[model samples]
Target: MSDTTHAPRAILADDERLMREQLRSRIAEVWPELQIVAEAKNGLEAVELTREHKPDLVFLDIRMPGLTGVEAARQIAQLPEDDEWAVPEIVFITAYDQYAVEAFEQGACDYVLKPAERDRLLVTVERIKKRLAQRSGEAEPDGPSNGTLQQLLHSLSARVNPGGAPKYLQWIQASVGQTIQMIPVEDVLFFISDEKYTRVQTPTVEALIRKPIKELVDELDPALFWQIHRSTLVNVKSINGISRDFRGRQLVGVKGLDEKLEVSRSYTHLFKGM
Candidate 1:
């Protein structure tokens, strides 16, 4: 029996509308068994959608606004463990020359060039199918190790931009009822979005800012803050542990907070072992 009787789900991310459509079409043709669950226009949206869908694979455009494919892939690969779900296999899509594509293959990473020629994409599809088959009955899914992928990102980063790593927001200025206060990013426990403002909480104080969670995601470092819900981002350092409620939903306990943050079904992959 073929292990892939159930179609594998995937996400496609590209900044260009036509590129996204063309890639989707090519994938459908050569890998019709792949069910595309989500599509994203930018890297940040790609990361968000990936978290929500937890698809079997992702095809990321190397260069996109907010976060590049490399950056998004890093975050997706590093998501908190959920033994129930495996991290998606990542295949980069780029417009780089044939030499760069060859280098990617040499590194044991899969990639599809721009416009996604049929023959080239078929090879990638077959490779992924074989890997998925190998992973079917294993305790852990087969894919590139996180460390190896991280190293790959470092090597490819220079090709994308020979510049410095992205810098996240350092401080947040919010209102505490009547007073405006400056909260250091390091001191924050979490940020929860309301109708008009986002609540900024610390061990000692709670403040409100007009910025939404979407905007905060762009500013905060993904290494520091993790989005547990669409409207919530919690500090990794502040997470005490995870617990399950009556309905089997996951909740995050913070170091100094009375209220536990709920983890949505889409984001449950963030707390795997718990």
Candidate 2:
């Protein structure tokens, strides 16, 4: 039996109002023992609230108006070890799928897709309970290592042809310089974030698309492609393997792609038990 007297503290951060409401409502319904201490619209506010409240858990969004969740997490990690702030477990909430693997690699406790399912949320809360129990006697808080997280993200993002009805991609036609090109999602090796737009990578050539990574995630099939990083998405079939660099950061090698994509530590859980 678990102790019910002590409730876990949490914070929710998301740019969308309705999504936040949905998450809060679901958390209340399924894991009422978790007390939400604060809410924020972006990573900057989330960072501030984390310092002030020092909650046990945080549900952070990957991309926000200011300071991405990944960046904010990096900053939070730099805080002095002697501070009152304990290492907060992170659960990233996003509509975008590409960052799912990356989120796990970054030491996020879990990744909850936008419009999170009740069953899934319940599982996440249960995991948190188990973690808290394991650390009950420890003085220095233990968190997931950045390396393990990156590997997990790579594996999770590599899940191909997830069970479901076939979801087709919407054809996109765009103008690149003087050439107008039409591309199909099937041919794309991945999508790379380019400032305001996403660059679609194909086997033979790369083209700049007007859609942001968020929009591309919705259009791309989850079974075929995954967002492994906030700035990068790759086709599962295109992935060659994941390797560790001298700096200890995980880099994903893709077939027919020359550049190695970075897989952050927060999103690594996606690769576990694979």
Candidate 3:
């Protein structure tokens, strides 16, 4: 992530479309000068768009599909240093109150709740503006670097899965006609879902499951099945390549499959130059 420009730019990422819009609108009210360059609907997209835009700040929802906000923040913190821009400041936007203790540990990262009350948002905006102004005044602007933030992030990450990470679904149970078939998750190429059924594609066969995308996201390992769209999760190892159409939307090619999966605008940042 980079922040070479003096003018502030920010990005919002959340799975809830309405929540994102609401936050954007509220932020606009609180800080009219802060430009929202882009929006993402998931944590994966949040990380990708941050890298692509190099915004001055990133507002992330703690809970999202594929990757959590804390995980995304860790990735942003570790992004390679760029001469053109500095890494962006991270702020957590969450409704969960349990993370508050860890969040405020050593005054790590700023946060706003789900509804984002105007008064609270104003405070958050002021703090962010102050930090940005401090950076702009410096001779060499580097991203926000504080050891407390890293510790806070680690504590938050561990708090998310206090006991340990649950075993991700390794075998998917799908209905093939009248017979139920067990498909190994690793062998599957991709999974797409609609309102009623989720289509599971493998090299040898295709199957359908009653599970919706939202539910499946929790059971699947985010590292293995990368979310390409709200209703689609493609296996990382199955990615053959990427291509584009006339309209400029990106498409992902899967190995052992001829069809290319559509990459939603929220996820185009994953492909670099969408």
Q: lDDT per model, in order?
A: 0.79, 0.68, 0.79
State which candidate has the highest TM-score.
3
**lDDT per residue (tens digit) for residues 1-274 in model 3:** 2343556889998765656777898988988988899999778898899888888899988877678889888888777766666667788987666786557555567888766788999988877776776666644443345566777888888876666776366566566775556577999999999988899999998888767888878878998988889999999989989998899879999987779899999988887953
List ranges where model 2 is wrong by over 4 Å.
Answer: 1-5, 83-85, 102-108, 138-143, 146-274
* TM-score: model 1 vs. ground truth: 0.55
Task: Tell me how candidate 3 scores on lDDT.
Answer: 0.79
- Tens digits of lDDT, candidate 1, 38-105: 99987899989988987878999876768888778878877765655667777888765542574366
Root-mean-square deviation of candidate 2: 16.7
For all candidates, the clash counts are 2, 24, 1
Stronger candidate by lDDT (2 vs 3): 3
Off by over 4 Å in 1: 1-5, 98-103, 106-108, 138-143, 165-274
TM-score of each: 0.55, 0.50, 0.59
How would you encode candidate 2's per-residue C-alpha lDDT over 111-193 as one tens digit per residue?
A: 78766789988878877776666555423445576455445434433332135333345344444554545566678888888
RMSD of each: 17.6, 16.7, 15.3
